[model samples]
Target: MEIGSFDAADASLKFGAAAEEAALNTNVVVVGSLERLRDAKDCHKLQRVLEASPDKMQLITSVARAMSAKKDGASARELYLLPEPVETDERSGSVRRVCLIALPSACSRHNSPARPHALTSCLKGNAGPGSLTVVAMLDDPSLAFATGCAIVRAFPTWVAQSSTAAKMQSKKINVIFDAPDNEAIPEAEIAVLSWAARAIRFTARLVDVPCNILNTTEFVNQARVVHALLQSTLQARGEEANAVSLEVITGEDLAAQGFGGLYGVGKAAAHPPALAILKYYPPGTSAADQATIMVGKGIVYDTGGLSLKGKTGMPGMKKDMGGAGGLLGTFRAAVGAGVPKKPLYCLLCLAENAIGPLATRPDDVHTFYSGLTVEINNTDAEGRLVLSDGLAFAA
Candidate 1:
């Protein structure tokens, strides 16, 4: 699933502004609290419908009471559908039918970040692929952004692993944030929210692919794609052409340059290993005299090398490169969002540890890029070997 595929917008919309109308005309309209519905500016019209029957009135009251006592972040209450749409306002216009989902306190405890996994259960059947409106009653844009991230996180449908590779598919759910009409939503906040959502989704997809589909060569290509995206994004802003560059070193180049740790760990794999570097030079500087470096382990798949892994231990080896995936995602988003006026560097150490005649043995002692000799007591500890070279390069 591609994160950037979704659309999100925060606008000057009131709390529960369309709840009554949406309940009668749309599929779903989510709200954070019951007070939003009970104390809405147009609640009288909704009150009349909710009070039409004693049972319905009791249900509404019960929900309000339950939500009032809810302390944990974002717990779901009983679902309620209104019998009719609210009386039309010439200024407000027509409303669509929707199911109202009320979330209790979200991130109210010590400013803790909202976790999408915690709230996924509450959102399962109520919201679907199309359009989802997250009404932030508290007037916190970060809350709205958090809620949007959760929505995107829970909405994507995963498929079974396949022999033939293809890009991950997402439903492209549209999310809208309804803030208080008096409040104004900032464009920068929206951009950050969108970028965050996309970056997370991109990382998840990267870690999910199998080693064959995302090996050393393929992973370097992926890094290159992020590099191109950063360059293009910078160029589109009319930035200097030399601002961003991506450099890759692999195979003989790694060995010749004394990257023994990296070369030894990956020499046995079908695809040659590589070290990918993404460099961002701020405007007006042609040289990167001193730069901050971020290093990531890109072990595409770990088969325990000469040490060998049991069947149970080998299944999820594809996710071994998670550090690299996260680094690339962050690099792409940070550059797109505009980095600080300093040289920024991201280094990826890419490799795959497989069993073969050419693989390094447990007793092998190899000299690393740092001029340190490491005795390979066990080849299963290859991640450290690759990282040793990466750390040396960064130093």
Candidate 2:
């Protein structure tokens, strides 16, 4: 899947202003907060792409107006299908469908505005293999990044078979941000949003893959790929020395280095366990500079070890590495946007808690990086073991 952006002028030319013919065979969906949809200027800019079909435009406007009149607790989203397929030029041989969606105004105490979640749900099946153009109306420019991230989440990139892979391989999603009062979003902000979307999709894909295909070794390889990409990017900017650096300690080396917690949990798996560390030292840093450290539990899969979980409880243990995946994505996104002013460290304590003859049984004792000993009571409690080593290393 690919995500690109369009400024207001570019959107006008590409969608409707420059030519009488609408974009051929495209699916256009416009999304906005309740306040933005009610604003005259925001609504006008959002509907600009539909100018060729005034009847369809009128239908969408009527629905929006009707929604505006409803009580505060009304449904968070409303989708309206165009009454007729948009006319197209002969060479294209297809017509277009337009959809309009309104996001919720209310936000819960524990959540940000409901717009991002609502938008993601509304876009799920709508973003198939064909071309899709999303016109998003934002009250604040920063929401553009959230909107992009949400859209990427709607289209995940994991499929089991080769035949189904094609369905997930290629998709084109174009986003145009229409700010309140028709203000233009800065080019720099758009670039950041694009990188964020890329990172989000990358992380989601890693989490979606099963442990059989994405074991401890494959996870390390994936981290290396991100490291290599970061190096290339820094090299292009003539700041190669500022790039993030990676280090891996695996197999017996983990035990030799006194990482008994990590080594013990993963010793039984077919693949050996590992601890991967990534460090970023900005230029001109000194000993006086404060450092930030993040540690993630990268259990490739958890079978609860000898104290095993029931079949119903173990179905999705492959997602045990979500913390690591999320941290990796955040690190990549932060570096891509710009180097941090402070020093940064990311520690991925990777292991697979598979049951085997070598597995840590109940009452087993293991020493951690902090020189502390812990007795294994419930083997399913392995996440804390790996995390303890990572935190001790960070300290």
Best by lDDT: 2
- Model 1 C-alpha RMSD to native: 6.5
Q: Give residue 84's lDDT in candidate 1 (0 to 100).
A: 37
* Alpha carbon lDDT of each predicted model: 0.66, 0.72
Give lDDT tens digits, candidate 2, residues 292-352.
8889999989999998999899999999999998888888877776647887788999999
TM-score (C-alpha) between model 2 and the true structure: 0.85
Q: Per-prediction RMSD in angstroms?
A: 6.5, 5.6
Global lDDT for candidate 1? 0.66
Q: Stretches of candidate 1 above 4 Å error?
A: 1-74, 77-117, 120-126, 129-133, 136-139, 155-170, 179-182
| Candidate 2 weakest ten by summed lDDT | 2-11
